[model samples]
Target: MSVHETIEQALVAPSYLAGGGDPGWVTVPLHRACDWSYGHDPLMPRVILTSPDQQATLRIDPDPDEPWWTVRHARCGDRPAWSATFDARTPVEIIAALTDALTAPTPPAPGLEPYDLLRQAGWHTVGEGLISPGRIAAIEHYGGEDGPWFADARLDQDEGGLIWRAYLSNTTPPHLIAAFAQALADPTPVRRPVGRVPAPAREHTLTRTVHLPVGDVAFALEQRVAALSARRKDATSNTHPPRSPRVPPPRRTR
Candidate 1:
């Protein structure tokens, strides 16, 4: 149906494959979402999703031999869910489904400024068209009018399948990063046979790690300014220009 639908279907797969009957998983929203570059390959398709409750992450892989794409689920929260596989012929449906699902009934936080949303959602803002290779990514604090991060994706296709490396930076709780991870690990239909495997055009393995602080830089600046002001006050007497008062003529009372 949709990418979101596929994920839900994949997640809610009959559960019979594992064992006897169990309560099937009902549909749910995808609170967060992201996408990355994926060229045709038989192995891993670069697409993934994380649950709205911050509970689980899902990955879809491309499988040539199987009827359905393989799906992996990692439950971050207390609930234990096993990884399974499913099919997705068209990916647009799945992506749209996720967008719709994430837009569901959850109440927006009270007085959530854009910054708050970005922080809680773990996202970053990046300048438009600034993505490139081998540059320390440029990003602002999460939730400002300007974004905190952007990604330049590198894709490689070999005899095996597609492999993707995305240089990501963002102040928004790194939600896009999480989405990338989820998408990479999630299964997808093998659009092309594992072409001739080449030396990975970019040298890196399965994962790339980035360490950056996330949140409001402006807020930090404000705090710093306040601190400096207090220190300045502490260092000096209140010796600015003294106030001058004008005396009015005595009232000619009766």
Candidate 2:
């Protein structure tokens, strides 16, 4: 088979495990699979499947020139939480591996030690273990808006763990920090299944015969550009809060 034909066949295959509607498995759009940045790559033929909670995204990008496909596990953002490449496997085996990887419990957020989770969650890190001006601003802003709820808010290290810190203060309510920590840790809640579930559908399929040298490669290239342009537009237009995975709650020493 031609390279394009091989890639298309693989892309169209059912690569995700089947499960119930919610708290189960579902297919996500190609653009939503990984960051649009990855889809923009000319040589990577990509597809993605996501769990209902939006906590996990499984990305499959087949190398056009090679026999293997690169699989990535991602959270809500563009960066993959984990990744691996598979070769000498059928589409079924690839899907099984993808399922195993996704269903497995996620490890701690990548680089939490060097890259502070607080900094990643929109709090700025200042010198000598101080909070950033931006982080203080955010705290103050939220504190003002939230009233007495945030009055005593301050960042404190989780008792023995270095992975997380608690927002604590004498007057600040415990739940306040608890909720914030939860939100920071599991930013993407498990998405409940939506209504009237349509059977899972393939977002893209090769309809007619596509010759490799001309039509298929050209089409793939066009898709890459389109995906890239869309991502650029999103980057320019949207102002989104930084996200972090659910970290262990700060030790409640209060």
Candidate 3:
């Protein structure tokens, strides 16, 4: 059966035991435990479904000049195991191939992994079969290798919730790790959105549930830290308030 079938089955099937409540939405959480790999680039890779529709591919090309980027290919209708390549710049034509493969009226395999599930729910990427375990495990969405790296994307039903692990690799500063860990632990956005929303307020909650894998979380942390550092040069040029002046102490007794 395809992933759609599995979802249908799960919907009617009795809820199974899991960490979070309501098996109806538990798939998002359990999927987080599954592992996915990434390239050394500071950003999350772009996922492309291959033509001929064999496996889902996560590709990261940090250097456009380089022949190849990192590729992690996972077969559909199979368990989470995947094959990875450090350098392989794929041709642009492959995007069309992937789109055709996924947009097909019927998928060769019915049951899809988490990556496919999110796509079926209306999420779109550059390619088909391009679902990544990280994408599905966590509801991460971005364009190209360049990113707005999200640490955790999650969904909740009646207070029950699921969390993703969206971490990146090769980080130096420690606070950045804390920031990601903080985001993961506290998905709340006590802070306000920096920009304006073109649309009127909808019933949607400010917070969302993204089921990112733990491996992805580490990767996201790295990306966030690096991005922060890149801004430091510009930030240092700005001015700051000096330390508060201290008042003089009263005279001591003789």
Lowest lDDT sum, 10 consecutive residues, model 1, at: 15-24
Candidate 2: where is the Cα deviation over 4 Å? 1-45, 66-68, 74-80, 88-91, 94-98, 104-254
| Inter-residue clash pairs, candidate 2 | 53-190, 53-191, 185-245, 185-246, 185-247, 186-246
Candidate 1 ranges beyond 4 A from true positions = 1-55, 67-72, 76-78, 82-84, 94-254
TM-score of 2: 0.20
Q: Each model's TM-score?
A: 0.20, 0.20, 0.17
Best-to-worst order by lDDT is 2, 1, 3
Question: Residue 135 of candidate 1: its Cα lDDT?
Answer: 30
lDDT per residue, candidate 2, 104-139, as tens digits?
233223334312444565455343332433232122
Count of backbone clashes, every candidate in sequence: 32, 6, 35
User: lDDT (0-100) at residue 234 of candidate 2?
Assistant: 65
